[model samples]
Target: MKNIYELVTMFHDVHPFVPSLSQFAECVVAYIGVFVIKSVFKHLVCLECLESLYSYLTDIRNYSLIARKSNDGLLFPAKDVI
Candidate 1:
């Protein structure tokens, strides 16, 4: 969570946006809720649970990169048709 806070701080600092710690906490809590709920049902082992989270984060990073690169501002290109 400290890492997340630092990353959020750095992102807002670089982008010159207002930083809302409450909103950040809310988002983190929501993700934690989802993780807990999924884990409860899935019975994932520790390593598998971390891998699932890592994969989801990686997908989010990739999506952001794709959105940043696209002129039309769509997350997925029209040609990709996802």
Candidate 2:
């Protein structure tokens, strides 16, 4: 398995984790490939970026929780994971 800390560190340094408005605007422009998606593309891109950020944060949180429990010699129940 990959080192959880390494994964967390990598993601911590990534852009979307703490995005600026210009970065958000850039992402919107980057994802606007087709004419059909042009009108709502900015909103879609913003939402997608936020969703990705949320997903990554949740994964890190879950991994840290599991790691803490394991390090304390306790079992992390499957039911507690999302």
Candidate 3:
């Protein structure tokens, strides 16, 4: 999970404006959702796993907000203004 998050973060940092990044993130979340659903049906998922997945999703959302803000220059003070 940490690795996946890190990879996504790196991708976002490199290509923040790419539309495919959003699609990639959505696909990852969807894949996780399917895994969770299958695990639940098979009685393989535990409470801790669910909590961890929730935490991951929250982190992704927060990171996305940070990325957006950075793109808008809100995360860093302006160095040059005309």
Q: Name the top lDDT candidate.
A: 1
Better structure of 2 and 3 per TM-score: 3
Per-residue lDDT of 82 in model 1 = 15
Ranking by lDDT: 1, 3, 2
**Model 3: which residue pairs collide?**
none
For model 2, what is the error of residue 12's alpha carbon versus the real structure, in angstroms, after optimal superposition? 0.2
Which residue runs of candidate 1 sit more than 4 Å off their true CA positions? 1-21, 43-82
lDDT-better candidate, 1 vs 2: 1
Off by over 4 Å in 3: 1-21, 44-82
Candidate 2 lDDT tens digits, 60-79: 33335334334544322221
- Clashing pairs in model 2? none
Q: Worst lDDT window (10 residues) for model 2?
A: 73-82
Candidate 3 global lDDT = 0.42
Query: How many Å off is the CA of 26 in candidate 2?
Result: 18
Q: Is candidate 2 or candidate 3 better by lDDT?
A: 3
User: How big is the RMSD of model 2?
Assistant: 19.9
lDDT of each: 0.43, 0.40, 0.42
